[model samples]
Target: MGTIDQTTYTLTCPQCLQTEKKKVLDKGSNYGGSHWQEGVDFSEFDVAWAGGGTSEPVITTAVCKKCNVPPSIVSSYS
Candidate 1:
């Protein structure tokens, strides 16, 4: 099983070398129910747990704020 996490990324563009911050929310789990399971795949059964959105694997339109890259696709921004 994979653990879901919400993360903020500070991305630096190689072309323009401008850094920008973005938020990507991934809700791994939720609280509540008749009882909270310690270790279970609640998302499989609950609609509330569903649609824990994830960040895009690639963002191709990220523009550098400084020099502005020509729509460089983002592999990873740290």
Candidate 2:
């Protein structure tokens, strides 16, 4: 019914603590009085191999430039 805001996902590498933008879905920080669940959904992409299993839920296709974090952390800040 209304407009969807752009969302910016932040991921910090556990090894280096590098922060990266996994995806930009909605816009605006405020939800315009809309109720949104904090960090509930996730959009997984193909990231680098961190020497872990594909289903480890720790590795992601989106790597942080600074810490090279995975995409799993994306849902943590939604």
Candidate 3:
């Protein structure tokens, strides 16, 4: 099989209002519990593992050319 280069979005934290890039994996697998089966597919599940409760704007450091803000002053709001 050919190797594929996966791309990811470096997300920032929304709470503290800091601009930091985060690297995330593309694919992941999770095992079921007693009430659930081991081989059961968790794709249908809508569970939030981490960084789920973000209520702020995303980092604007890499803003598009259409925006008026400068890249240096741009901030990532999670």
Comparison by TM-score, 1 against 2, better one: 1
Model 1 spans with C-alpha error above 4 angstroms: 1-4, 28-57, 70-78
Query: Model 1, range 1-78, lDDT digits (tens) per residue?
Result: 233443344556676555555444433445521221221121111111222233233232344445545333323322
Cα lDDT of all candidates, in order?
Answer: 0.35, 0.39, 0.26
Candidate 2 matches the true fold with a TM-score of 0.32
Segments of candidate 2 deviating more than 4 angstroms: 1-4, 21-60, 64-72, 75-78
Clash pairs for candidate 2: 5-26, 5-27, 6-26, 6-27, 7-26, 18-67, 39-78, 46-61, 47-61
- Clash count, candidate 2: 9
**Model 2 lDDT per residue over 1-78, tens place:** 242433455555677655555433222234453332222223223353232221222333565454434534554323
Candidate 3 error regions (>4 Å): 18-78
* Most accurate candidate by lDDT: 2
lDDT preference between candidates 2 and 3, better one: 2
Ranking by TM-score: 1, 2, 3
Per-residue lDDT tens digits for candidate 3, residues 6-61, read 22333223333334333222222334211211111112121122221122222223
For each candidate in turn, give its C-alpha RMSD to the true structure in angstroms: 12.7, 10.6, 15.0
**RMSD (Cα, Å) of model 3:** 15.0
Clashes of each: 0, 9, 1
